[model samples]
Target: MSEVDNYEIVRQKLTLGPLTTPKHRKIRRLLKIFWNEKEINLLSHFGPADEYNSLKQLQERSGLPKDEIKQILRNPLRKGTISKRGTKYCLEPIIPGIFEKYFQRSRDTEENLKKAAILYWDLFKEVLPQQDTKVDNDWSLFRPLLPLEANEKIIEINQEFDVQSQTLPYESVKNLIDKFEQFAVITCQCRLVAELSGEPCKVAPSEMGCFIAGPGSQTMIDGGIRGARLLNKDEAIEFLKETEKRGLVHNAVFDKGDQSSIFFCNCCGCHCGVLFPPKLFHERGAYQSNYSPKWDNDLCTKCETCMKKCPQKAIYHKFPVKSDSSDEQMVLREEMCIGCGVCAINCSDKAIKMVKVRDNVPPDRQKIGNKTFIEMLQ
Candidate 1:
C-alpha cells in the first residue's frame, strides 16, 4: 500500500497499546516527525504494542529480505521508536514510547524537539481532561513507594493483619533499590518535556531523573543511550535520598507487588507525566501507597511544614472559627493524597507519621490494576 496507509496502520497498532495515540491531526504530525516513510512502512509489518515479532516473522509478513528489514529497523531501534527483545521487535505506544524516546535524547535537532514538545503537551491537556470526569474509577500504571523512613515503627498496621507476618517488600524506596544490583540514572522525561515546553520543574533538576534497575537494565545502559549513566548501589540510595529531601515522591511500576519493580522515578507533581494530568484536573491518577500521614494534633504546632512539603497539595490548614481561640489544625484531604509520605518525612515537629491505611497488593506482571496491562493503557 501507500505511505499514508502505512502511517494509518502504525497508528492503529499504537492505539492498541496501554497508552493511546488518538487519531488527531497533531498525532499524524507527531507520527511523521518520529518516523520517516520507510520506517512507518516497516512498522506496519509489526503487531500491536504488546506483541513482538521475530525478524523471520517480519521478513515473511513484509515480503522483504532479512537485510532490508534490519536496515529499516536500525534507526527506529536506536531512536527507541521500537521495542526489542533478542531477535524480536515490537511497536510502542506514543506517549510512553515515541514521545519519551524523542525528547529524552540530546541528539535530536532543537527545532524538531520544540515541535514534539508542543504537540505532546497540547495532546496531554486536551485528552487527559476527558479522563478527569472518570477519575473516581481510574487505574494507574505507576504507584507510590513510601519513603524508606516510613518503616513499621512510623507506620501503624491494621489490627486484623498480623504485624509480624506483614512484610511489605518493594513498598519503600530502599527495599526496591535493594532488589536489584545494577542501576542506571537518566534525565526525567517528564521534566525534560516541561523544560522544552518552558515550564521547568521547581522541585528538582531534570537530571535528578528516574532509576532503572533490575535485569537487562544494565545491558540497556551499556548500550550508551544519550543522557544516561551508571550508578552503584550506594550512589543509587544516595540519589533517592536526595530526591526525597527535595520533597519529591518515589513512584514506580511494581507489577509484582512486593516481588518486582520494573522502574521507578523521583517525581515532582509540577511536571511529572504520571502526576501532572491528575493534578491539572483535580483527579486521582496514581495508586496510593498503603500508608497515609496521621497527624498528632498536640505535637503539630501548626508550623505548616508538612503542608508545604506535600506534593499533592493534599494538606491544608483548617482555621478555627473567629469566635474560638483554638489553633488552626492541619487537615488532610485523604482522597487527594497518594500516601507518598512526603509530608510525614518532611515534618520537623514529628507531628506527621505514616499510618497503614489500605493493604491491596499491586496487580501481577502484565497487568495494571484490574485490567490486563495492555487493556489498561488502551
Candidate 2:
C-alpha cells in the first residue's frame, strides 16, 4: 500500500463531531476516489473542523515546498475536504460543513456540480442507515433550529436567561441573526442536492437560504466556501422573513459546540439535511429546537396542511371517536415535536403556537455553558 492509501486516517480525522464511527468507511473510500495520493495527505494535514493550520504549518508538516503545498491545497479545498479561514485551512464539518461547501463555489461546470452533489447525497445515505431510532439518547449531527415565535404568539420565555447576551444566539431568532457582526446567505445545501438529484424541492426554491455569520462569515466569503451576501441587520431580518413566509424552519447548528453561530438556516422537511434524515429514519428525538408546538383546537379546522409540511412527523390528527359532533383536531406529539413552527405558521386557522418546552433552561447559555438543550432531546 502506498502512503496516501491511508485516506481513512484523513477521513476519520475530518470531523470534530461525536459521530466518529465505522459507518463512514464506505464514504471515506468514495471521497478518496475523488483525490490522488498527495491530495489525501494534504487532506490529512487537517484534523477536526476546528483544527485549522496556516500554509506554513502544513508545509512544515508535509516536508513539501511551500508552493507545492499551496497548489496541493487547492484540489481538496475544491473537493470540500479542507476549508480556508482567511489564509488558514481546516477540515470542514461533515454535516452542514461539507454539504454547504460545494454551493459556496462561485462557479462550476453544471456537470461537475452535479457529480459532486450526487457524491454528497450518497455519502449521506451511508450515514443515515448507521443511525437507528431505537437507540436511546439518539440525536442528529445537526438539530432543528426553531426560530423565535412572534412576540404575541410566544406563550412563555425562559425566565432565568437572556439570549440577547453576546455569547448566545438561541434566545430567539431575533437574537440569532441580529447579533452577528458579519452575515452571508447562500443556497440551502440540502435543497440543492435534492434538485440536482432530480427529486426537486417540494417546499421552497433552492436559493440563498443558508447563512454564515460573525468573523467566520468573512472567512467563508474570502475562501469561497459560502457565497457571501454581506447583509446588514435589516437585510438579514428581511431575508429570514422570506423563509418564514415560505413556512421553512430556521435552525441553528452546533458542531463540537461552536454555537457562536448567530448563523441560521431556513430548512424544509423535504430538503434540509438537519430536518430530513432524522424524520426519514424515524429518528424523531434526534434533534430539536428549544421549544415545542402548542395547538388550540378551538381554531383548528382539521387542516392536514401542517401535517404535510411537518418534517419530524410530530403532528397527527386526533379524532373524538365517540363524539356525536364528529370533530377531528390536529395535535402534536410533545415527545417528538421540535417546535420548528411549520404547522403553526402555515395553519390557516392559526390554531398552533410555539411554546417553551424547557422553560427553565435558557438557550443563550447553552452556547457557552451547558449542553442542556441537546441533553433535553436525549
- Best candidate, TM-score: 1
lDDT, candidate 2, 1-378, per-residue tens: 665455677666644444442436556654655567878767666655556688788888778888898888787666554567678877654544554554656255577667767766665555654554332332343445544445445334454446442123443566555566557777677778777877778668777577656675666557665345577767777777777767787766444244524455777766666556566666553345556677677777886888877767777877777656456677677666676766776667777766655532322333212122222111
| Candidate 1 residue lDDT tens string, 134-165 | 23323456778877666733565667667863
The CA lDDT of each predicted structure is: 0.72, 0.60
Runs with alpha carbons beyond 4 Å of true place in candidate 1: 1-5, 16-18, 104-107, 132-139, 157-160, 165-167, 177-182, 214-217, 257-259, 322-324, 366-378
Q: Estimate each model's TM-score.
A: 0.86, 0.75
- The runs of at least 3 residues in candidate 2 whose Cα sits more than 4 Å from the true structure, single-residue gaps closed, are 1-4, 21-29, 44-63, 78-80, 84-89, 106-109, 132-149, 154-169, 176-184, 212-238, 254-261, 360-378
Q: What is the lDDT of residue 198 in candidate 2?
A: 78
lDDT of 1 at 45: 85
Model 2 C-alpha RMSD to native = 5.7
Residue 8 local lDDT, model 1: 84
Predicted structure 1: lDDT: 0.72
